[model samples]
Target: MTMRSRLTTNRLFLSPFTLDDVDELHAILADPRTNTIGSGPFTAIAQTEKWIRNRMAAERDHGLRWYAVRQKATDVLIGNCGLFRGRADAEIGYLIHRPWQGRGFASEAVAAVLDECRSAGIGPVWAIIRPHNTFSIRIAERAGLRLARIESDERGPLHYFVTSRANT
Candidate 1:
């Protein structure tokens, strides 16, 4: 199924990423608080550029793309949310800038994406979150993904959350 390029919520908007987003996206990704659970913060603009290019290619080749999350009123980018092909099912993930955290933006964006997933007939979506990221874990649970197991990879332990058949 073809996913829409834009999604909206009461206070936020989600659109596909473009190279033009590099500067703002780089700032967000470079923030230590935002990258605490993942690889360390990005150190260069080229990294962010490459990131956008890769996601754009993924959208073209795999039908999976990351959305640039922005505030509707201000039209300022604050984070991102998207789905990725996973080992068993599509996986969902999101990140909100520290300045925008605790304001429910991440949760809102995730819920909107989950609704999109449902409409697209993508079921049993997974959320692979670092065990220490309690904030993300809470968002995953609130989005109706229950913990199925904990798995480890090169990145260490990760909590695997999946949408229930009934929920999806």
Candidate 2:
């Protein structure tokens, strides 16, 4: 029963994540292809749940929001998108299931999340994509997040992108 002013697109909805979404998320984690593009333990559902749960518990935004994506027609869970409190900025990230990839779903989900960030009064929402993750870069472009920086993470330095009100 969580609610927010941000509205994901009508064809699909990006609403706050709940514990109830465990099963859908489990499937996403269990698939190697999805994890490879999105990054995770492809064959382990429990591990995925733990990872998401820990993210849910993050006080980064003083516990602001995380969204689980669902289709409008069938309520089929597709993926997730969220705004996290980074060291000096707010960032958005998303992952689409293998079945949903290359279908323009990720782009749509990001649009929904950026709209959410706007409603939340966050400026210049950022995203960090692995160099090879072109799908994410496409979504970021659709959402108006431009390439801002290219720095490394624990995994490696990445192309850090940003979407701001000016760009939108």
Clashing pairs in 2: 151-157, 152-157, 153-156
lDDT of each: 0.88, 0.72
Model 2 residue 138 lDDT score: 82
Write one digit per residue (lDDT tens) for candidate 1, span 1-168.
Answer: 667889999999999999999999999999997866556799999999998888888778777767999999999999999887665647887989999999999999999998888887777789988888898999999989999998889868988899999878
Point to the candidate with the largest lDDT. 1
lDDT of 2 by residue, 1-168 (tens): 122634558678777665677778888767777777435555666776776676676524254466788878888988877766664466787888888888888888877777766665666778878888887788887878888778876787688888765743
Query: TM-scores of all models?
Result: 0.94, 0.83
The parts of candidate 1 lying over 4 Å away from their true place are 86-88
Q: What is the lDDT for 158 in model 2?
A: 88
Error of 1 at 113 (Å): 0.5
Relative to the true structure, candidate 2 has a C-alpha RMSD (angstroms) of 3.1
